[model samples]
Target: MDDQNKNLILATVLSFLVVMVWFWLFPPEEPELTDLPPVAEAADVTTPSVAAETTSTPTTTPAASETVAEAARIAIETPEFKGSLSLQGARIDDLSLTQYREELADGSPIVHLLKPVGEAEAYFATFGWASAEGIAADQVPGPDTIWSVESGDALTPETPVTLVWDNGAGHIFRTEISVDEDFMFDYVQSVENTGTSNITLRPYGLLRRHGTPADLKNFFILHEGLVRMTDGELEETDYKKIVDYDLDPREGTQAVRLEATENGWIGYTDHYWMTTLIPEQGTAFRSTSKYFDSRDLYQAEAVMALQTVAPGETTEVTTRLYAGAKEWDAIRNYENEEGVTGFLDSIDWGWFFFLTKPIFWLLHNLNVIIGNMGWSIIALTFILKALVLPLAYKSYVSMAKMKELQPEMEALKEKSGEDKQALQQGMMKLYKDNKVNPAAGCMPILLQIPIFFSLYKVIFVTIELRHAPWIGWIKDLSAPDPSSIINLFGLLPWSAPEPGSFIALIAIGIMPIVLGVSMWLQQKLNPAPTDPTQKMIFAYMPWVFMFMLGGFASGLVLYWITNNVITFIQQYTIMRSHGSKPDLFGNITSSFKKAPPAKDAPAKPKNK
Candidate 1:
C-alpha cells in the first residue's frame, strides 16, 4: 500500500476501534427478569418490639396504600412541582413536575415524579421514627397510622403544614412539612414526651419504588436507578444490582449500607428526574439501599442517629426531600449553596466527566445567551474549532507540504525501485529536509475522537438537551433525527424504522446525509488515491461514518457536520496560504472521470 493509503487505513481503523470498544464497554443495559415475592400488606409484617437502642431487625415495611378511600392527604404546591402528601404516612408521594412533561407536544401530561403506594409501579418517600425503649412500636407511628392536620390549610411554598398524632400515652408526634419554590421539601419531626420518663428514637427517611419504571431508557449513557452521595464519595447502583445482592439477615432484604458522618444523600434517579433524601449537614446517618423480594420494592434510606427525649422535653430532627426534574442549575445550586456534597455528580457524568462537564458547561452557557440549544451546539463547535486551530493549522500545513512533495516522492520511489527500506529512508530524509512531520497529519483526527465522544456523552446524558429543539421537525436534540430517508422525510405515509434497528442504520436521516456530504467535500481538497484498494476505502469511508453515526443524538450529529465544514474551510485557507492551492473543484470533477494509466518506461519488451 502507498504511504497515504497506509495512514488513511490506520486512522480509520483506530477511530472505528475506539468507537466499538466504547460501545462494548458501556453497552445498553438489558432489563433483567426478577422473581419478586408477593407484596405483603402493612398489617402482615409484625412491628418491631421496642428496644433500648432502637436497633430492630430491618424487615420489609409496606408503604401506606394511597388507594385507601378515607386516607387524608396534604396538598403540595410549588412553582416547579405539585403533589399530595399522604397523611397516613406523611409520604411525599403523588408528585409531578410542572415545568416538564411526558412529551414535547401540547396536551402531554406533566412529568410525574412520584406515585403513591398501592398504585402499580408505586414510588414515594416517607419519614418517621423507629421505636426505642419505653416507646411502644405503635407509639412511634407505623406506615399506616393516620395523623390529623394541626396547622396549615394547604401546603405551599409560603405556607407550611403540620400534622399531629398522639400515642394515648401523652407522647405527641408533630411533623412540620415545608416546601420551597422549587423541589426541596423540609420535614421536621419533633416529639413531646409529656408522660414518659424518657424515650429514644431514630428518625428515618425512606424512598421506595415498587417496580422498575415503565419508561426507563435502559441506555448505558444515562443512569435511571439508585444514586447516592456519601461523605464526599458518590455511588450509583442499578436496580438489577440491588435486586441481585445477597440477602442481609439484619435488614431482611438485599441491601448495601454506608455510614456517613459529614454529608450525604440517597435517592432514586430517573433519566431526568430524581427523588432523594438529604440528611441535615454534619449529622451522622446510616445510608441504606435495599431491595425487598417480598414486595418487589427498591428502597433507599437515611436513618439518623438515635435521640433521647426526656419527660416534658421535646426533641426534633430535620431532613430534606428533593423531588423534581434534575435541572442542572438547580442541582448545582444545591451542591454549592446547600452543602449537599457531590450533589452535582448525581447527574451521570460518566467516565469522561472532566471533558463532558466543561463541554456541557460551555454549551449550557451559550444556550442561555443564544436562547436555542441547537444554535448553542453550533456555537460550541465553533469555539472548540478556534481553540484547536493552532494545532490544526500545523497539521494542515504539514499535509499541504506533503502534497507539494508528491512528485518528488514519486521520483524517489522510481529511483529506489523495489528496495522498501531505501524508499522509507529516502522519504524520511525528504520529510526531515522539508521540516515536515508525517505524523502531524494524524494529530487532528486523534484529538477529535475524544472530543466527539465527550460531546456525545454530554448530549446523551444531560437533561438540558432533552426535548431541546432546532428548526423544522428537530424537536429533541438528545434523540436521533426523526425524519428518515426510508420515509422520504415524512413525504411517504409510513414512519421510519425505530432507532438502533438494522433498518434505521441504513435508512439514515438528513443530518447524517449532510454529515457525509460535508466529509466528502472535505476529502475533495486532495486527489483520490491512485491505488485501487486505497481508492475504494477512501470512497466508502464517508458514507460508512454517515451510517454509523446516523442513530446518534442529533446534537452530536450537528456538531460533527459543523466540525467537518469548519475543518474544510480552515484547511483550504491554510493550504492556500502555503502556496499549495488545493484544486478542490478540479479534484471533485476528476473523481467522476477515469484516470489515464501511468507512462511506461519506454518499450522494455522489444527484445524479440
Candidate 2:
C-alpha cells in the first residue's frame, strides 16, 4: 500500500515537474528572458583546416571608396524621389552604395551600381542625404582613393564576368536585380566556379561607404549587428564594426591589419532579418568581430578557393536583401519572391517554404478581414480552441463521470482500509466497467501545449507585431500590456521602468494574475483530496502559478485564461445535460438517486 501510494505521488510530481520545465522553455527567447539562452563554447581543440584558415589571408583589394565623384556630366541629373526604383540596362551615373547616415534607423539609401559609357574619368565619387539623416556620399579627389586594377590580360567593361585562375579555370560571377509586383527590388548576385580546378571561395557580400579611412576604420557605423549563435549549429554574426575588420596587403597567408589612424567602425549586414554592427563606445567603438568566424556556419575552416572545378561545372550562391522597414504588406509581397524570403530569419519560419510561412499568410489574410492584431489574435485563438474543443469535451466527460463516482470511490477506499492495491484494483475495475479513462484530461491539455507554443512564437518574433496596437492600455500586443496604474512617483511605473517600454512593463505584470486565476478555477472544480496533507500542499498551486508567470507576455497569459474559460463553459454544458450540478464537486449520491446497497454487496464504509 505504501509503495503504491509512493508511486502515485511520484507520478503526479513527475508530471508537474516535466510540464514546468516545458513551460519554462516555451517563452520567447531574447536577451531579457528570465533565463539567458545557453551559449556553447568553441572546442578547445583546433582542426588543421581551421589552422590553415587562421594563417591564410585570401586575396583582397583596398576596399572601394565610399566617395563617388560628380565629374561625370550626367551627375547633375536629378534622382527621382519616391520609394524604390528598378533598373535594366539603365546607365547609372556617379554610382554609390552606402548608408545615408551613421545611424541604423536612417532610411535605407538608394544605390546605383552601373554607369553609362565614357562617364567616368576612371570613376566619379560623391554622397548625398539619401534619407535626410545629415549624411551623404562624397568624392575623394586624391590619387589615394582610386585603384586601377592592371590586368596582365586585356579586359573590357563588357567582359561578361570572367574568372582568371592559375592552375585551374577561374570563376564567373554575375549580379542580377529583379522587382516584384509591389515594386520591391531584390538584387540577386551569384558567383559560379567555372574553373577546371575545385575551389572553396570565401564568399562575403561587401558594401563600402565613402569616408576617411580614419572614419571608416575607427568610428562604429552601419546596422544589422549581433550574431545569433544557435545550439551546435553555426550562423554567422550580423555585422562587425571594428575600426579595421578588413584584411590588408592584398593576399597572403597572414592575418591582415584593419585598423585606421582614427577611431572608426564598420558593419556587415545581410538584408534586414540579421545584422551585426559595432556601436561607437569610448576609445573602443562597438565591434562584432566574432560574427565573421567562418567556421561557425559552414566548413570549420576558412579558405576561399575556386578549387578543382571540372570543366563545365558551376557552384552558385545568391542572397536577398530586404531594404525596408517592417511593413507587413510590403514584406509579405517581398517574401513571395523565389529564394528571397530566407532572409527573414528573425522568425524561425519553417524551412519547407510552405508549412511555417502559412501561419503568417493566414494571419495577414484574416487581418484584411478584421484590421487589427488584437482582433486577429482573438480570432485565431478562438478558431484554434474550436478545433481542439473535442479534446476538452472528452476531458469534461471524464471529469463529470469522476465526480459522479466520487462517493462510491470513497466508500471503496474505506472498505479496503490499509490495502491500497485492493482499493486501486477495485477502482480500476469500476472505471473500466463504466468507460472512464483517467488520462483523458491529461492528454487533451498536453496536446494543447504545442499549439500554445507556436502561437507564442508567432506573437513574439513576427515583425508584423512590432508596434501592433490593441484596445485601450494594451497598445502593443507584441511588446507588453500597457494597462497600469499611473503612479508617476513610483520606482517602476506600472507601464514602464524608466528606460523600458511602458507597454511591455504593464503586460508582463498582468500575465501571472490571469493565468493563476484560470488555474485556480480549474483546480477548484475538482474535489479536495481525501488525504489532508495532499489537500494542504495542492491548495497553494494557484498562488504559485500566479507568481511564476508574473513576467511572461500578456498575450500568452490571455490565451491561457481564454482556454480555461472555454473549458469551464464546455464542462458546465456537459454536466447540465446529465441533470447534475457541475458546481458541486461530486454528485455520487444524486447520480444513483441515493439507492441502498444490496445484501450480497459489501456495505459502504465510513470516511477516515
Best by lDDT: 1
List clashing residue pairs in candidate 1. none
Please give, for residues 220-255, the per-residue lDDT of candidate 1 as tens digits: 667778899888888888877888988766566677
TM-scores for every predicted model: 0.89, 0.54
Candidate 1: stretches off by over 4 Å = 1-56, 59-69, 410-419, 491-501, 526-535, 585-608
Summarize candidate 2's per-residue lDDT along 1-608 as a digit string, tens digits: 12244346537655765766465455323332132121111211111121132332222222222222211121211121122111211112233333222222336444333222222211111110000111111211111122221121211112211121121224443333333333122323333544454443322222222211111111111123322212212233322333224532332211222322222222232222221111111222111132123312111111121222344665433322222233445544433543222234433442332433665667777778999877776676677778777767777777666666666666766777888678777777766766777656555556675666666666655656655666655555655443333443233634344324434334345545667777777766554455556666667767665644444455666666777777666777776665556554433233434334323227655334
Best by TM-score: 1
Q: TM-score for candidate 2, please give it.
A: 0.54
lDDT of 2 at 527: 43
- After superposing candidate 2 on the true structure, give the runs of residues whose Cα lies further than 4 Å from its correct spot: 1-57, 63-204, 207-272, 275-320, 324-346, 350-361, 484-511, 527-534, 584-608
User: Global lDDT of each model?
Assistant: 0.79, 0.40
